[model samples]
Target: MQKDIYVVGLMVDERSTKAPDVQQVITRYGSNILCRNGIPSPSRERGIITLTMEAAPNEYEKMEQELKNLHGVTVDCIHFSQQESFQVCQK
Candidate 1:
């Protein structure tokens, strides 16, 4: 059975935020990062990044923690969509 989950992408500074550090955190919790986009900001303080991935059932907490642990980085928005399951209805 396939379960639905909310995938939360994050954007943060690269220099300020340690890449290996963040990767380690995510790896600790077992998260598959689909894609990561790095965008340069006006100030080097922190850059914007976008992550695309899928989460398991009720695994948002894990993803949240992984990203939140990083410095100067926070979850922008989490878009969740419902996934339908297959079942037979009886009369």
Candidate 2:
């Protein structure tokens, strides 16, 4: 098994999709959103949504691929924390 990862999802829309649109993405990806922020987009009718989530290491790639394919949703970045391995000292 791989180490757990932290993923950030950004919803950038040229034209905002409704609630169903956003929900659909979450459902499809099975991602647990940790935090979210929304702001009005100056260039278009849509707004930008930023979200953070914890992803299962094994499933990270699949989740990212699915999310990117969703309408009005794009992954801005994916961040991961290195898991340190420790060993017991023997006398």
Highest TM-score against the true fold, candidate = 2
The models' CA-based lDDT, in order, is 0.55, 0.58
lDDT of 1 by residue, 3-59 (tens): 344444455665455666766666665555565676766567565656555556446
Tell me the RMSD of model 2 versus the true structure.
8.8
lDDT of 2 by residue, 1-91 (tens): 4554454545656644544566566666554556666676667766666656666655655666666776666665556645643222111
Candidate 1 segments exceeding 4 Å error: 1-9, 27-31, 40-43, 83-91
**Root-mean-square deviation of each candidate, in angstroms?**
8.2, 8.8
The candidate scoring highest on lDDT is: 2
